[model samples]
Target: MAQIAVFFLFLAVIQASVALKCKVCDDTDGSCSKLRDETCPAGASDREAACLIHIYKDATTKKEMTEKKCVNRFKNTGKYDCIENPNNQQIKCYTCVEDFCNEKNSATKLGLFGIVSLVLSILVSKIL
Candidate 1:
């Protein structure tokens, strides 16, 4: 009886840790207006717990291109790869953990560093 209870407990833990669902698309602006949601595959690591968006730009024409997909979360240091060009092809990647987070452009959102900086500035001003 004890062994059966333990087995059921383990199953509960696995069920509780089910994978995430995120918007999957590759639009010019990273919006999911016309895209669908996908569940992150099982066995995905913690790093892959977030949705990612990659934006690219054409150096000469200034045309913007974007790609949205599931990606691992960034750790202590940046974790992305891009092509290099002497011209001006710019590439930027963003990651968010919330459901359908990649549906909209996150450039308008304040990042962790920005929030921390704002708090520190307010505190310093109060002190001074």
Candidate 2:
């Protein structure tokens, strides 16, 4: 029973270490709307695993552009909504830490649920 509990605990920890898959596309080429999956390098650092979506308007052309890719995030960062660039207000950016999370533009809702499920499974295994 304890071995089963240990196996469940190992799986939960392993889940946290996997790299996230972020959408990688550009509106300039119209690939942003495609279904192909682009992923960051496996086992990348936390800073390099987040998804980034950058959208902005062109200054001279007055056109809007969009880009999506996995990008390294600033250290010690928290979640943020799409925000205007400080240097160029026309550029808006959003970053998140789950697979294709940039498109969703929100925190991954699975973390808490996964933790709860892991705990419950461990308890059930011990009881058995």
Candidate 3:
């Protein structure tokens, strides 16, 4: 029936929108800096659509810290609240939609990939 077709189409569109994925990782050494392919968890809400990366320094030790997670902007308006002293302790928050957009070193990876591709292309050309 026409109604059934329309309903199915609507459902498909909703599914696609809700199924949006984002890279997720929490690491101190930055090993998990790479973006993941599939990011949606079971029964995730709309707020989890955004990727959040929060970088700050330890108050006592002054060690660089990083927190990467999925956030719902509707609930969390501010990214950092522990900044009691701006000069001593400062926090930076980054929000993005694309996968691995939160990775601070993403550009480095892309540059390395480009270099490798160029080398391979040159080798192929020489061989031919």
Candidate 1 deviation (Cα RMSD) = 12.1
Question: TM-score for every candidate vs. truth?
Answer: 0.49, 0.62, 0.44
Strongest candidate by lDDT = 2
lDDT, candidate 3, 13-42, per-residue tens: 454455435556644464455445456443
C-alpha RMSD values across all candidates: 12.1, 4.5, 12.2
Query: Candidate 2 vs candidate 3: which has greater lDDT?
Result: 2
lDDT ranking, best first: 2, 1, 3
Model 1, 81-110: lDDT tens digits are: 444465756577677655566777773432
Reference-based lDDT, each prediction: 0.57, 0.64, 0.51
Backbone clash count, each prediction separately: 2, 0, 0
- RMSD in Å for model 2: 4.5
lDDT, candidate 3, at 88 = 45
Candidate 2 per-residue lDDT, tens place, 1-128, comes to 67777777777777666777777774455235753467776432444567777777755555666767776664467443555544444555777766666664354545554486599667968698
Worst 10 residues of 1 by lDDT: 107-116
How many residue pairs of model 1 clash at the backbone?
2
